[model samples]
Each structure stands twice: as C-alpha cells, then as structure tokens.
Target: MRFLLVEDNAELADAVVQRLGLDGHAVDHAGTLAAAEDCLAVAEYDLILLDVMLPDGDGRDFLSRHRDHLETPVIVLTARSQISDRVGALDQGADDYITKPFDFSELEARCRAVLRRRGGAAKNEITLGEAVFDPMAGTLRHGAQVLDLRNRELRLLEVFARAQGQILSKGQLLDRLFSMDADVTENAIEVYVGRLRKKLDGVGVRIETVRGLGYRMDT
Candidate 1:
C-alpha cells in the first residue's frame, strides 16, 4: 500500500514514514496542505495520515474539500484531543482519528481496522490450524494457550498468516521485516524465519521454502 503523510513536523513525519515503510508500504511526505493537495492531484494513495494543524490550511478543511471525490481512507492526527475536535473530523469525512502521543502499535492497528473495513473484512482474527493470529492485537493463540512473541516475529507471522497459501519471495520477506532505516540484510529474514518456524513447531503450522521461489505457510 502507498500512503501520503500530510504533516508539518519533520520529526513526526520521519518516524511515521519509517514505521510504515517497514510494514512494506510506500510513503510520501508532504509538509504543508498545499504540498499534500498537489500530491493528491497527480498520485493515487491507499491511505492518508493527516495532521490537523498545517501551515497553509486546516487538515479538516482539506477533508471537507475532497469529501465527495476522495474514496481513500483518511486517519486524522491531532494534538487536540477534545471531543468536539474528534466529532468534527469524523463529521467532515475522516475514517478514523488518532490523538497525539499515541502508541505506534495503536496507530498500526487503527490503520488495519480502516483497511479491513474498506475491504469488507469483518473478522479480526485469522486461524491457521489451531493457532489464531490477530494482526491488530498482535497476539497468537494455540487453543487455550497464548504464545508470547517478539515484535518482529509478530510482524513476520502476520504477513504469512494473512496469506497462508501464497508464496512470498525473499525480497518480499525482506520488505516485510525491514525498511530503509533498518540496516538489515537478506540473511536476517532466514534467522527470523527459522525462529518463527520453531515457535510454531507444535502449533500445527509450518513455513515451507519453495526452491527458486520463496516461502509459504502450511496450516
């Protein structure tokens, strides 16, 4: 997925862009409302992470401006956590709202929630054999027992569990595991895959490597 991040703060934009990029999404940064409008004019984006305060104009006004034509999901980011602010943003066509100083995990979860709604996916948990994986919550359950997993493991497993039957190449796995800021090599994926495979040992699942192709999860 490609995202347009409409933010004025350079630090926040860098952090969010790097995070989204690590999730294998292409992100474009626009520091002002005009830059955002210009990017929206020519390019297509799956999502927009918008800051309510901008140098040129209010982001909520921007939402109202493209209310009729913009079908992509917009999640508002604002320092103001007032009820009226949240209500106004939603009323103006924002898909979801996030307050400032939010947990990055929550932001990721909210993004998935909006995307799921857009794709008409009603279920939040995915089942692979006896193991149940919740991408939003970042949890895995095997029967009544819940497995503790690292952040990287959870991210990697989510990718496979979401696409249980499809094969993902090493390049794809690398994309899922690390981004531009992540100074990791292709071999890093092997280490994670090995660890994840062991973690799911008795969980009634296996990740198989296809020669000359990639990897697939068998449930």
Candidate 2:
C-alpha cells in the first residue's frame, strides 16, 4: 500500500518510513501540512499517518479541512494522551489515534485494521483464475504453491485486485506502485506488467491492454 506520513520529527519519520517500507509499503514523508497537501495532490494513498502537531499547523485542522475531499483513512499519531485530544482528533476525521512512545507493532496492527475496515474484509482475498491473491500475506498462491512475487509485483497485483475488472491508466498504477521520490521510469511499469503476465498465463487471471487506454485485470 502507499502511505503519506505527516511528521516533523526526523527520527520518528525515518523509523516509520523504514519499518513500513520493509513491510512492502511505499511511504512519502511530509514535515508540514503544506508538504502533505502537495503529496495529496499528486497521489492517492491507501492510508495516512498524521502527527497531531506539525511545523506548519495542527494536524486536526488539516484533517478537518480535507476530510470531505479525502476518503482515505487517517491514523493520528500524537503525544497528547488526553481524552479530549483523542476525541477531538476522531471528531476531526481521524480513523484511529495512537499516542507517542507506542510500539511499531501496534502501529502496524492499527494500520491493518483500518485498511481492513476500508476494504470491507479482514482477509480481502482476490481470486486470480485458480490462484488466490492475499493482500495481508502479500502473496499469490495456486493450491499448494506460492508464486514468487517481488514486493512491487505483489503491490501491483493488490492494486489490480482492488479495482478488478476496471481499466487502470499507467499514471494511476505508477502512483500506487512507486513512491514520489522513486527514480523509476514509465517503461518500468511495462517491465513489471510483462513479468506478471508470464507468471499468470493460463491461470484464470488475464491482464488486458486496451489499445491506447491502459491495462485491466480480468478473471
């Protein structure tokens, strides 16, 4: 999944980014509301991790301003443990609130739970022909054998699964598969698509190219 992290603390930002990246998620870090807004304009995120206090303004204010526009789930990370603070953040549109000095495992769990709620399932499995795509496990399996999918490949599959039977333009897939700072080319998407095609060949799944439009995943 792709995430936007609004945080001013460099250390905490770095730790969050590194940990989430290891879990096969693309993260973009913004130190202020301005930077976060910039990121939001360019990409659609699966989730957002927002700090309550930012360099530019309060995260709750930012949340309130954009809540109507953004349906993406947000998890607020703040040092204020007061009940009012938590209630205020939630009322301002935060999906979950996690106080500082919290464990990364707990953060991970919260993210998963929020995403699950958004997707409407805990497993959120997608059937690809005879194969099954599991977002939580980050794998594609056919009966007993698990297909060897790299992180990007698996992420691409997840994106397609979520929007199954719909055409996805190259730009949309690019934003979902790569981070804002990733030094990747448009043709790189074709490379990954080609690889996925070969692996899924003869399986119930098909990646169809719609002439000049883009690609669609069909089952």
Candidate 3:
C-alpha cells in the first residue's frame, strides 16, 4: 500500500518511513502542510498517517479541506490524547487515530486493517475481459492458459486492475510500483507496459496506451 506520513519531526519521520518501507509499504514523507497538500494533489494514497500539528498548519484543517475530495483513509497521529480531540478528528472523517509514542506494530496493523476494509475481499480477484487475476496467489489466468508474469508485471497489472478503466499516468504507476526514492525512468514504464501487453494478449485483455496521457485497461 502507498501511504503519506505527515510529521514535522525529521527524526521520527525518517524512522516511520524506514519502518514502513520494511513492512512493504511505499511511504512518502511530508514535513509541512504545503508539501502534504502538494503530494495529495498529484498522487493517490491508500492511507495517510497525519500528525495533528504540522509546521505550517494543523492536520485537522488539512483533513477538513480534502477529506471529502479524496477517498483515501486517514489515521491521525497526535500527542493530544484527549477524548475531545479524538472525537473531533473522527468526526472530521479520520478513519483511525494513534497517539504519539505508540508502538509501530500497532500503527502498522491499523494501517493494514484500514486498507483491507477499504479494499475488501472482492478486490482480491480482478476480472478484465477474458483475463482473471488472483492477487493473493499472484496468478493470472486467461481461460485455459496461465501466463507467466514477473513480480513487476504482477504489480503493474494489479494497479491497473484496481483502477480498471481509470487513466493512470506513468509517474503515478512508477510511484505505485516503486518507492519515492526509486530511480525509474519514463521509458521503464513503457518497457513494463510492453511486457505486460504481451502476457495480457494470451488472456485477450488489452492494456491501451492513451497517447501522451497514460494507460488504461480495456475490456
């Protein structure tokens, strides 16, 4: 899953980012509200770990501004453990709350649970045209033939299947498949798409390129 960690403390932010990365999550760190806002404007995150107090503004205010516009689940992380603060954040549309100095395991568990609930079991199997992909097993089947897909191919297909018909740009796909620090080129995305296209042909699923826009799955 992809996550946005909004925290002002550089040390804590680094720790969180490293730990989350170890847990197989793509994490982006934002030290201020402005950076967080910029990240939100461009990319979609599976979950957000928001610190209540940011350098420029309160995280609650940020949530108020974008909660309704984005479907991403947010978990507020704050030192303020008051009942009122928790209630306010929740009422403002936070999916979960974590107090500061908490265990990273608990936070990780909450993040996974929230994403699972949001994604649901139906998302485990994606069907596009004659192709059926089982994410848990990392298997792609096109009728009677099974296509051999690499790890990156599976991840790419999963992202497109999750978005389905939605247009996803190369940048967005790179961020979803790799970390913020990955040294991926624009051509890398094209190469992956070309590879996926060949495997998808066996199943009669077509991944259409949208000129200068991006790529989309066509059933």
Candidate 4:
C-alpha cells in the first residue's frame, strides 16, 4: 500500500513512516496542507493519514473540500478527544479516526481495517487458487509453502491482487510500487513484473499482458 501522511509533527510523522515502511508500504510525508496538496497532485495513495492540526490549516477542512473527488480513504489523526470532533471528521468523509498518542500497533490495525473495508475484503486473507494472501501480515502462502518474495515483488502482487481482474497499465503499477519520492522509472515496473511472474508461475493466478494496454490478473 502507498500512503500520504499529512502531519506537521516531525517525530510522529517519521515514526509513522518507518512503521508503515516496515510493512512494505510506501509513504510520502507532507508537513503542511500545501505540501499535501502538491503530493496529491503528483501521485495516488491507497490511504491518507491526516493530522487535524496542520501547520497551515485544518485537516478536516481539507478533507471536506477534496472528499468529493478523492476516492482514497482518509483516517483522521488528531489530539481532539471530543465526540464532536470525531463526528465532524466522519461527516467530512473520514473513513476512520485515531486519537493522538495512540499505539503504533493500533494505528496499523486501523489502516488494515480501513483498507479491507474499502477493498471489499470481509476476511483478512484472500485466497487465489492455492495461494493465500494476508494483506495485514504482508505474506503470501501457497498450499503448505510460504513464498519468499522480495518486497517489491510482494508489493506488485498485492496491487494486482487488490485490483484483480482489472487491467492495470504499467504507469498505474509504477505509482503503486514506488512512492513519488523514490527514484524509479516506468521500465522498472516491467522488471518487477517479470520477477513476480516467475515466482507466481503455476500458483493458479495468472498475470496476463493485454497487448499494448497493460496487464490483468486472472484466477
């Protein structure tokens, strides 16, 4: 998963970025609403961890303004413990809300919960033929064996699995695998795809190249 963390607290932002990175998710930090807007203009994210009290403006107001066109889920992170604050965030289209000084584990669980709900995953595990993907644990299993996939390879597979059966262009894959801050090219996606294909060979899930268009996964 890719995330945009809109926060001004450097320490909290750094900690969130590191924790999510450890789970194989790419994250971009935006210390202010202006920076967050710039990041949003350049890339797409699976989720947004937004801090209410940004350096420049309120995050809830930002959410209110963009929620109409933004399909990505947003989880409001704030120090406000009032019921009105939580209600206001939800009314502004926040998918979830987390209080400040919360545990990293809890934040991770909330992220997974929001993603699962948004992705229509009722269960934590997604089974494709004999392969089972645990989005939370970032692991893939085939029958009795666990696949030793590289981080990029696993990320590619996760992207394909989430949007299964839909055609995804190389450009779309590139954005999902690498963050806007990362120095990567469109052709790098092909290299990762090739490697992932070799690993998923006979796993009952097929990655089909759609001629000049892109690729699609079929189970």
Across 1-219, the per-residue lDDT of candidate 2 in tens digits comes to 899999999999999999988877889999999999999987889999999888789999999999998999999999998999999999999999999989999999899889988888856677878998887667888989888888878888888888889999887888887788989877888998999898888668999998888899999
TM-score of 4: 0.91
lDDT of 4 by residue, 63-145 (tens): 99999999999999989999999999999999999999999999999999999899887877988767998867778899889
- RMSD (Cα, Å) of candidate 1? 4.9
Instruction: Write down the lDDT of every candidate, Cα atoms only.
Output: 0.84, 0.90, 0.83, 0.90
Q: For model 4, what is the alpha-carbon lDDT of residue 171?
A: 89
How much is 42 displaced in model 3, in angstroms?
Answer: 3.1
Against the true structure, candidate 2 has what lDDT?
Answer: 0.90
lDDT of 2 at 92: 91
Best by TM-score: 2
TM-score of each: 0.67, 0.93, 0.69, 0.91
lDDT at 155, model 1? 76
Model 1 Cα shift for residue 154 (angstroms): 0.6
Worst 10 residues of 1 by lDDT: 174-183
Model 3 misses residue 22 by how many Å? 3.3
lDDT of 3 by residue, 1-88 (tens): 5789999999999999888766445788889999988888777787899999987999999999988887999999989989999999
Lowest lDDT block of 10, candidate 4: 173-182
